[model samples]
Target chain A: MKVALVQDTPRLGDVATNLEKTVELLEEAAHRGADLALLPELFLTGYRLGDLVPEVALRLDRPGPEIERLAAVSRRIPFAVGLVEESSHHLYYNVAAWFEGGELRHVHRKCYLPTYGMFREGMDFARGDRIRTFPTPFGRAGLLICEDAWHPSAATLLALEGATLVFVLSASPLRGLGVGRHNLSIDTWVQLLTTLARFHGFPVCYVNRTGFEDGLGFGGGSFATDAAGNLLASARDIDPELLLVDVPVDRTRDMRFAYPLLRDERPELVHRELGRILGRTEETP
Target chain B: MSAPVPLPMDAPELTRQLEAFLHEEITKAGFSRAVVGVSGGLDSAVVLLLAARALGPENVLALRMPHRDSSPESLAHADLVIEKAGCPAETLEVTAPVEAAREVLGIEDPLRRGNLAARVRMIFLYDRAMARRALVVGTSNKTELLLGYSTRWGDGAYDLDPVGDLYKCQVRQLGEHLGVPREVLGKPPSADLWPGQTDEAELGFTYDDADRLLWLVVDRRVPPAEAIEQLGLERDLGRTILERMRRTQFKRALPLVCKVQARTIGIDFRYPRDWGL
Candidate 1:
């Protein structure tokens, strides 16, 4: 599958402007012959919303002009855009909307919401409880938000559900890690992604935002790595750029056979533990 | 020994009081001399001049340790500042040591190489200070300190700091009054890490804007959103500052030590500055 990563800068709280820019970038990627396009996390409303979260968040089905425009733009190539999704009953999510063939196909709510430091995700977003892998025309793909990728359990579950590719929408503030007078710990996250891709035997298409929002900087180190954890495309730091890569579906099957992590799984030790989730424990600790 | 009185931010007597306070601390700490890295940058220039004033020109040693990539202008500015401030000067070419250390550590990246240079300079300053029984005074200003802009165990490491509270721009103003060379003050600020690399060039924000915003956020106690709004800064720029605010918390704090007792170092067992007195 040929995918293009849009490392475009989104204006904070300028939903119309950001959505327009995202659509334009997606179209630009499609024009460049990409079968699919990926935009950074919270591309629709921009990442830094501070106190404007409630005002800017939109219901998942509400066209709201921005969503409709995105649907209109997705006439040919499938595209994924990050947004703050509002549901009924005041439930909000750090969400990504997958648009394919001029329609919204799937909405992936972020499972793991980060609450550390500047991020107070728990106060704003209701956690997503379901893990799903969608069967796209091109391939079986899984989607996760930024913090969700940090959890190996999510990736493992997606892989078990036969996902060959994963798209991670990240609004992770750069924290001045890579470009600073201090030691940058963001590279540690890169290693984590690499391990996840290798273990799951799935190519991870990671996209991150750029520009500063509310004094929080986004280091745009977006990249795509193959199932073997070989980096295919990398974006610049704290700058806007587009990254494109092509991977054949067969490449994943080849890697899985070579590594055989899927086949050699010790189900007796691990899968049996999963059975506890389905059981109601009578004893409380 | 009495506790330091809290001084107003812009009090005119600050310089004199600061000098006296630092001198007393140095004597009590048992250091006979003081060493300062002469970067020719405003931050270093202010600190160097302060050290000279506090502990006479003879007692303060100014070391200009430049790497191979350091600009000649930066070095020349250092010499001019030394001449103007009347402090003793020494130059240590760090290229050989840095190269050897890089080889020994197997560090190959440009970033790590720059960090190694900072650490090497610190090592030289510390060693020379130890030889002279001097303390290495830090040159970092409040802005850089707040942003965690210095490398830990590198620029962040120091025995004492005289100009740690002043912002970068404030340091320039203070340096001017201290009779620092105009050429040194006027020159574009740089760490002289790589060829033609300027501090502002790497930071992606001018020191003036960064420091001003920092004062508003940190000293003035403005919220991140309100600070950006009042400053009329771009959202991305504001976000960048907030991210730095979040990430650099470690730089402003003592290293995290796990607590195994009732009272920890920074958390509960805090003591007055003049506790023993």
Candidate 2:
């Protein structure tokens, strides 16, 4: 139930340095007795490689040596690191490699690609289609990327799929006074995720990166909250730091029972709403 | 217009075209009158001139909001231009509101009091606009806008900006072309929020330096370090310009809205206002 969130900088287009830092942070987390550790988005190549993506992208199965080493290292505790994964037809993906029990448990690709000013993820990589939960020794776990965390569908679907805990990996840019004013966004993110958790009777772990990359800074205020939306742990702003929190399933169940958001079943209407986004072709009664 | 040097195209012709364009946009937005703060600085002078040409001098109202410590010459310059442009002018000294707000909020710092001055000016401008059913004409130039120099919800608040695109130097040229007073065009540009508080003194970079660098970085889309090298400017100055651009992003965005439902606005459903045909 103990988790560690790493707030470290990724050197631009330097995969070797990124992996080295990831291993060092994972070791540090394990030393602190953390059962699970999370890293940032695109940690292998950093976030500044706009055109270097093709050169740095590694095939999913072609990450053979790196995956093997990380899996072996995960024998002590479960770890997740962000990287570029090459899929079928040579398409690239921003993927999270979840390692546990000396093996690769799941490779989750980022679903949402922010296409606003200075971001063109949709043009560079393919979108993730699958939305499902993976069984972990701790609970039914789910994964999401940076922009994915902003979408209600990503987390809501995961909750509907019976995930007791959700892990969100992000690499957001900082914008001085304007950006700091939205510090409550971290709290808002946790609130919505916890609302889903309480509605489905679960907990959520939201992780984010810290420091600047190519003049774009990260606030690094990563946090975890229970089903009742209480802050279990929080990190500092604009710095490299990690926080470990012990989240219990019994706590979620007890709070959910008291809140009874789950007991007030309205699945019929909610499913109809989901049908709208899924489209008429994919809808079922 | 022809007297201003280096004019291949007559400044009056360019001013006419820009004014016509402004009129069209204002009509499209369903507005007839404009309210602007006249500081006697180059930026506001150019804006007031443009507003007079766009919406007529009679329809353009100039508010001279000066603090207690503001230069008397600023008011003189503003009055001269107001007379020359044939526009109606009003004066609202900011001492009363500033003192009252400082006492109520227990604000002791001079900087906080200056911000209150900016907010008071905005409040008066908006009040005039509301009473006349006009739009508050903004006078911030490209340099200040790019550097994020204006206070948010204070001087930064405006309904329509007539001169936000021109740099400070360009504004001075345009002001001269539009027949703004010589003293007004020659004087240093400041917000006049506080006594003897010059813009360049606080910004640590001259308007000319900031404008040239910003023009290269934004209009030319050149990299920051390379732009600094190409312009032969100081490294720290260039870095400050880039950092300001990055930091002021929120002022350029729509309000943030949490998407509790699919196809919600802001967080999702981010299509153009004119997206679906």
Q: What is the C-alpha RMSD of each candidate to the true structure, in Å?
A: 21.2, 22.4
Badly placed stretches (over 4 Å) of model 1 are A176-186, A266-271, A274-285, B1-41, B44-277
Question: What TM-score, over all chains together, does every model reach?
Answer: 0.54, 0.52
Per-residue error for A73 in candidate 1, Å, reads 1.1
Name the 10 consecutive residues with the lowest summed lDDT in model 1 chain B.
B1-10
For model 1, the TM-score of its B chain against the native B chain is 0.90
Write candidate 1's Cα lDDT for A187-280 as tens digits.
6557778789999888888888765543355666788888888777677655678888886666788999899997776766676776876685
DockQ of each: 0.02, 0.02
| Model 2 Cα lDDT, one tens digit per residue, B223-264 | 888878877877887798789778998876667887788677
Question: Interface RMSD values for the candidates, listed in order?
Answer: 19.4, 18.1
